[model samples]
Target: MKQRSSPSAMTDFYSAAALVTGGGTGIGRATSLALVREGVRSITISYATSAAEAERTAKELDSLGATVLVVRADVRSTGDITAMFDLAANKFGRLDILINNAGTTRYVDLKDLDGLTDEIWDLTLDTNLRGLFKCCRAAALMLKKSGGAIVNVASIAGLRGVGSSIAYSVSKAGVIQLTRVLAVALAPEVRVNCVVPGMVLTNWIERGGGGISTEEEAFRVAAATPLERVALAEDVADVILGLVRSKLVTGEEIVIDGGKGLTY
Candidate 1:
């Protein structure tokens, strides 16, 4: 193979400032680590309330010689999201990437209107759909000036009907639509995309979410997927990192569902 030019060699080094929401655990945590390995200088990890885990992650990244800021910002709040990104811009001097990964979920039986409750439905939509809106609005402002990349952590639930809960499925479906809309709206200035993952082996799932259970049956149901197994956080994170650099990839949904969305 012939030697590559200096420009190609500097691609990884060029990743200076990046921000990832929900970075306290799972896919967010994996992506945060991956960014550091790719030479991202400073990163802001945003979480709703997981302060201890966030601080621990910050310390770990700092120990690796990377500047990691653990910021407490609920994606559901427009004010909080906007302020957090503003703080990130000031801290790093330049914003290069944004990963909209923070989300909320619950399980519900749509048939039982009384049991589902209006509050539950609203909360689900608020965080998964409205929260994404708030973060994208703020991130858009930063990326327009600097020309950055955004990867929304959507889920297979968004693409199909299976998920932790009924409200979760609906909220995620909205997220998929939001991703496409923003990808077009942001256009040439900022590259926006989304990732849809299937049964990822995360703490949230193993511990049982609202509508989903951590039973042998659930695992069997997921394992029966096309890939015959589930995915790890790192597996999905690798895909997110690749999508972040593509100048041509926008208004696209990259499915990382272990072929679960595909034929058996």
Candidate 2:
């Protein structure tokens, strides 16, 4: 794969700052790196429990000559989320970008109603949906001050009904809707958009055992895709980079599944 050194379009991010939630790994990590490569001067990345991963990401970004702040935060806690925004604002002096990428889910059969316990539902909705809303709300002031942009990492599961779990699917669906609502509300000041990724080859899936339990299943899914492949974290991040750089684009949801979603 040809790596993108920076966003295709030029952006003033070289002098700006950003905050990326769940930036420890997966698409979040890729987005964080993309932002740094695109010349974002300072970034605050939040990780729930991935301290090792967060440290690794920080080191990588630091090596690239970007100011990085790694915070331990749980999206479910309003206080932690608020602190994340405050730290970014205080350290960076201004916040120009917010990436709502923190999310959680467990792999469960859709037919197993008993397996979809209240705890699982709460965990998924609180982190994936409600927590994202809180982050966006907390970021409003800083973003408005700099006329910044917000890019949410939703999933193709949100558009369809297939995902790791029913609650996860519902939560992501809420994220898609939330993106549109925030876009209209923050208009003329801050832009809000989302990227819906489909079946990305990330450790997140393996951790949750998201039905692709074997390499064979993954290969089958890839073969079924029109593009003969699934999405990569960097692929989704590139689309996000475009959204962040485009001053004229807002309230849009970009699908980055390499045409796999079309089959669904």
Best by TM-score: 2
- Candidates' TM-scores? 0.89, 0.93
Q: Write the per-residue lDDT of candidate 2 for residues 147-175, one digit (tens) a residue.
A: 88999999989988798889999999999
Error of model 2, residue 116, in angstroms: 0.5
Q: Residue 252 deviation, candidate 1, in Å?
A: 0.8
lDDT by residue for model 1 (1-264), tens: 994222311145345688999997889999998888877878999998888888888887787778877889977777888789889988887777888889877655546546766888888888888988888787776676667788998888887867767788888888888888898898767778899987777777755545455455447756667767778899999999988878677878888877776764
Model 2 poorest 10 in a row by lDDT: 2-11
lDDT of 2 at 29: 96
Instruction: After the best TM-score superposition of candidate 1, give how far the Cα of residue 102 lies from its true spot, in angstroms.
Output: 0.3
| lDDT (CA) per prediction | 0.80, 0.87
Pairs of residues clashing in candidate 1:
107-211
TM-score of 2: 0.93
